[model samples]
Target: MAGRKKTFHGVSVGILMVKTGFRRLPGDVGHAGTWDFPVQYRVVEGATPDKMMALESSGLLDEFKAAALDLVAGGVDGIATTCGFLALYQRELTAACGVPVASSSLLQVPLAHRLIAPDKRVGILTFSRESLHASHLEAVGVAADTPVEGMPADSVFVTAIKSGDTVPRFEAMRAEVLQAAERLLGSHPDVGAIVSECANMTPFSADIAERFGIPVFDGVSLINWFQAGLRPRRYPQA
Candidate 1:
């Protein structure tokens, strides 16, 4: 392969981060420690969690595109975002960046749907159930009727993320996430798998999976799969 024009090398993914002050735990996509492979990050100023929830009117698509282009110039093989709601811009970002872009973990929903039993369905746990509309799911090839559950509006998980709490209550946040999962499973007993729509929820994916006895897919899972394709491992010949 021909060498590409890049300021740096060896980074396979460039993560476009929303500007926020929330504490990013180890499993969060924004945290460097969450990834086994090195990743580059570019923060899109003014892209807050609230604005991202209503991305269609956020007027930040251009800003996100510009940031992604900048990451490509800096040498990332692909693009990703810290917000799952960015799935709305999947087509635009992929076109603008001229590289593979996994804009949201929700992109895995269609595949998750296929991985489960014919009668079973994939459920979503999001930051705001109301904000996640049909267009967002349709953009990613997910069924508009897919079951979805959100953290309570006043729950610690939603509050900390929206307020950008620098000192988040980890246990409280975990509990809220688990409760949301429980609600999802309770309402839709046929949910064979789950896709976490908030990047911050990645930390509790294991707990959700273990507690609910269902497969949980989140930002980490999406990015790891994205990275594998960008830099597949090689086996030495015997």
Candidate 2:
């Protein structure tokens, strides 16, 4: 690409991360070990989880756009963010970055909806149900009536994240995530697939699918797909 000032090569995915000190587990987007391929990360300082949940009114769009453009300048072929709530800035970030941008895991909702039976729905497990408004879903073409469930404000998952707990109890966090998934599935029996809206929830995605016996989509899936397109594998001549 044009205007690339990269000092490195081969890493095509650039992750725009929200500033946090919490320990990122293997499946979390902020964790480097989560991907089979290489990736570069840029942290937007001061862009915390609470601000992301209120992104529409948070006035951080320009900051996010600037960070995305910086990544593009540094030579990443595509851009993605750590928080699914960044769905509100999808269009803006894509335009500013001048490269393919997967701003949120919620981008998979429309596809998840298509993957399931017509009578079934795509359920969303988010960081905050009260904050995931129709505009956020609509920004990414998800229907306004899509089913959603959020982790309880007082749950271990939320508290640890908000406090940036460096030594979070994985088992407790996993249980909290499972409970949220259960609420989403139980209240909406027609939910045939789940879209996890919190990038941090990816560690428990397998548990969700195995427990519910349904497909689970998250930031990892979206970024993996994004990376594939940016740097497709080549094979030896047959």
Candidate 3:
């Protein structure tokens, strides 16, 4: 009923996958010396349109791919790029990784669609205007018409992006993002679940849900599931 399987020890298995995303983030964009604290969100600080389009430091994308590959070589099952803005590079990275890379966390789009009825839509909270486009929608398996929203420049999050610092009032940032979500859901006539477009937004997931009374998803949790699905195992001794 299916293709032949690859077996390690006695167990047949699926391919390992890794996510590859843009790496424009600089050392200063981080907080507490760890990209671990909503690491991807700090991306906005460095990955501006000017920086992204610059030909000189264009190697940022390549750097991320290299990092992803190294991570995979070590034992990561699959890869998923943290930045949704990399939709244009999705196809390229998926091929380069030679594994079941999800390309972007937007893989949850179809899942979110299934989780709700046919007419509902999902709101995506992204870093900047670069995230909204037909190509990005297509890459995530969502319709071009799917309701989407961006983290507006006026918000504290956008301020964080530009200043590379957390706002004195994170509550304001959360409110702005949720405000965008509210507009999308209320106007679209079809928003079901909410998906965070940035890694930093993960910290706001539960907050968004509690405020909006709707499902909110971020790349980290979904990445874990994607990794879990393709995780490698140690074969038993014969």
Candidate 2 lands at a TM-score of 0.97
Candidate 1 shows a clash count of 0
Please list the residue runs of candidate 3 whose C-alpha ends up more than 4 Å from where it truly belongs after superposition. 1-61, 166-169, 232-238
Displacement of the residue 182 alpha carbon in candidate 1, Å: 0.4
RMSD of each: 0.9, 1.2, 7.9
Candidate 1 per-residue lDDT, tens place, 155-208, comes to: 888888788889957899898899999999999999999999999999999999
Better of 1 and 2 by TM-score: 1
List clash counts for every candidate, in order: 0, 0, 11
Off by over 4 Å in 1: none
Q: At residue 83, what lDDT does model 1 achieve? A: 91
> What's the candidate order when arranged by decreasing lDDT?
1, 2, 3
Query: Each candidate's lDDT (Cα)?
Result: 0.92, 0.91, 0.57
Candidate 2 clash pair list: none
